[model samples]
Target: MNFRIPIFSLLMIGFSQSAFAQIKEEQLILDRKREPEIKKIEKKKTSVEAEKNYPPREKKIEDSLNLRYTVTDVPAASDFKTSTIQGEDISPKFEAENLNNYFQLGMGNFGRILADGNIGTKLENEIEVGADFHVLSTSGLKKEYPWSSKQNIGNVAAYLNANGEKGKFNVIADYGLNDYNLYGIYALQPDADTDLKQRTNRFKVNGYYDFYSNEILNNVRLKTSFLGDHFNAKESQAEIRVNLSKHGVELPVGNDVVLNADLGLNLETLNTDFAILQENSSKFLNATVAPQVTFFNGDSYLMLGSDFSFLNAKNSTANTDQVQENRTYWFPKAELQFAAADEFKFYAGVTGGLQLNSFANLLETNPYLLSDQQLRPTETKYKGYVGLRGDIDQQIKYDFRAGFGKINDMVFFRANDLFDTSVSGNRAAYDYANSFSAVYDNGKVSEVKASVQYFPLANLTLDAEAQFTKYDLENYEHIYNVPLLKAGIGAKYSMLNKKLHLGANAIFSTDLTTNSFEITESGSQPNVFISTENNDDKVGGYADLNLSAEYRVHKNFSIFALGNNLLNSNYQTFKGYKVLGAQILGGVKISF
Candidate 1:
């Protein structure tokens, strides 16, 4: 009975304990479910509180302002104590020197003598006057050749120049006399001791005037000349030239046009008488009018012009033969120029004209010509040329030119024939080997020329020139006495503060064709029966070398020495002629 009661208490206690465990399990499940909802609500409340505590902030700005500044007045200048400093003098000093007049005298081998004098003066109003005189004489080298060779030459010249507000004026007068003996025939006629004397005199007067006005006519020139020989041959010429020119005529192409006109009048007369040849007289009247137009810019230029000439000539001889010619000729001249750079230029031209071949000109070219030569005018039909000139580095200069021309009645020198038996020795009187006769030939000529100048230093200079000429004759087989090639070179040097100067020059020429003759005697009067056979000869090429040196001893005094033909080459410039060998001259010069 007691066992039943204990069992019931145990059962009830166990049941209660089971019910409490069940209740605890249910609460744990409910807490797990409500944890997420509680956390969500707390997070929402924290975000709202944070937003309310820290509201949206306003934007901030920075302030920048400039400060004002006041400038003070500058301090007034103050006066300091007067002061002076003295030092050694350092100024430029100059010496005055005058060397307008000079006198020179010299003597050398072969009995040669030289004398020269020059004087010049300047006056108020820009007037200048000057005079010059020179004399050169040489006697024979050998006594046996007394009549073989002798020479005397003298010249005098004076000039006057004046400059005024209007323009310039100049007058010049000159006279020259030359005397020489014919010695070319001495080798053939050694026993015949006859002195053949020849003398020539020339006189000239020239006047020039230039006007500074703005008119077209600007310049005028007048010239008169007279030439005479020992054989009663006389020639006179008078010429007048007037120029009209206008410059700076603007053109549409930004160039300038120059219009120029030239008017010239010339009158010439010649008279001569020979023992064997008849007397001859010639008169010529020449008038020319030339008009030209030039278009020029700074770098290029072109010139176009034409010359119209009216010539009237009359030639008469003692044999009642007369020739008269009156003609009008037209010559066209044109030139083109271009400057490629500052130191280079190219130029070309085509020109043609008639040149007067007067007796004075002939005598000047060949002093040994006989007085009985005929006179005529030379006609150049056409001449065309192109040339280039330039400088290199401002120290050297060069020029090259090539040209072709056709000439009618070109004159050349030829030996005369003296063997005519009918002249009764009259032909021999004037037919010496030294004498030359003028001959005419029509031909075409071509020439090439080149020149160069170099300055290696401030006081040294050198120059060289070369030329080649070719001729195609129409009627003749050869051109007589004309060299095919010519060349020259010269150099000058100064040193010792310009107190010492030296100069040297050399010239070369090719061989020339000339006529010679062989002497023959017939079986009769030996003196009167001389005859000659024609033969051809050649004058060999020649070179001439000359040197000079000078040293200044004082401010107005100097000593100089010169040597010619230093190589002693026995070369002849003309057929049957002999030139002097080495010759030396030394002298002193005084200037004041």
Candidate 2:
């Protein structure tokens, strides 16, 4: 989804596993039920529209995702999860009452190979078991880029779910592997060896149970994960969440009220062999208890809550060189919903919390990040917002929201030092300033977002969304690599009695910024600092236009094709990285 220096001395620079060792890490993936990136794929699920909307599995129904789409997301996030230009929503909710199986195989230019499928079966004791998998690999952009390398990325998982009058439970495990080159404009060496590679993988387990009989333990979620690379850099993390609620209790007030509480525990430990300066190793943990009460009369409702948490972290370069850092925090939470009209509503809320920043998580966004550079957790001091949404008759729906917040330890990235210690030293395949390192800064942010959906005709769907953010930092001229303005617009049309589907998507983001570094040594000593005025570089923004088509050959089969970067973009997603361009994939889908 993301270089090789040919001059690399493979034998002399083979990554060292002899450094201080950190244990392994595991991961857990929880998919929310949302529309797939490809809307046509949803209709392809079944000939009957009713089955298209999966029968409810959990007793609780999540809010429908059809109203509005969440646009691009913050780059500083631990999970780096945000909607892309495609605006597709993907979450694994495998507990549907009726499960169908399908298999897809595709091939395209640039050696692109895509395969995805899911299999499930009903078991005794009201239990269900299934497996889902998707994998894609592409030849590097060497055809046009001359310097890019091929990439292979994908994931697969197995799950077991059961439900009854008492409750429901599910257990899942998954693993993912990504292999790519770190060919940066600056990292390239005359003798660079593109054949040498960097590989990363993660393994995880997730378990969840919802209870109907026990009020104290109504919902429990548990997960543990491990992430590491070929060099032995690793992160181990575990999490637990529980929700308890009391409903329909008679109170002194007129309307019946519900009391609820949530408990959470998250912990992680990481070790990334060595940075340019020091070995990186650290641990982070957060425990929190939140309680709230809600009262509703008619269509109007109100709720209030408070979150209290204790945060702890231990960071250092050596086993004995660590000091445990601890702090306690309290945040306010509240929301109000009013019936502005029978079909329209107005709502507002106040929310804030601590965001865990870990290498295991950050890698999702910037896979080119160095193996080790310990970073502090980013804290959201506070954020307040309001919004209103409704429909124009039966064909159109809209949503809007705006908010302002202050952040502590806001994180951003910059190029690594091209040369070791001010212009000299052996470098890893990724260290040529082509790779990014995390930097911490504090700042205030303001943002506004809006999205709309129109179904003018039964077979035609129109969607568009946009978001803009302003960052005012205390220590940087600009927030490098994070998008300041982003937007997406798409259209999907069905013809030939719904058997033929056509779609187009246009995803855009403003130009991104990057800061370079130069080292000058005074005699034998060296110093490190950014010279923003002279080193700042701009990476041009892009309009990634894509088109897709699919034809249902029969109730159990279909054929499809996808065209990416139809504009043959030369823009870079990162400072020096170029995206694969003008490629098409054709495939067949079979259902059983």
Q: RMSD, each candidate, Å? A: 44.1, 11.9
Candidate 1, residue 574: CA error in Å?
1.2
Which residue pairs in model 1 clash with each other? Answer: none
What stretches of model 1 exceed 4 Å from their correct place?
A: 1-98, 140-146, 190-192, 255-276, 419-429, 523-535
Off by over 4 Å in 2: 1-99, 145-148, 187-189, 250-252, 255-277, 318-320, 419-426, 517-535
Per-residue accuracy of model 2 over 1-592 as CA lDDT, tens digit each? 1001111112111211111021011001111321121121232332112222233422221112112222332111111112221111122122112228888787777787777777777687667777767776777766544554677777777777666665667677877777777765543442434443567888878877767443455567777777877566777777777777554344576664333333344333333344334666777778877787655544455768877878888788854488788999888888777857645768788888887777767876777777767778888878888877666776766777888888899887877765343434445666556677899999999999877667667766666667889999898888899888887666555666766655555667888888764433445455532222235678888877665565677868877666666677767767766766666667777878
Q: For residues 287-330, could you state the per-residue lDDT of candidate 1 as single tens digits?
A: 87777776656556677887788888888878867788899988
Q: What lDDT, from 0 to 1, does candidate 2 have? A: 0.60
Provide the overall lDDT of each model, using Cα atoms, as 2-decimal numbers: 0.61, 0.60
Top candidate when judged by TM-score against the true structure: 2
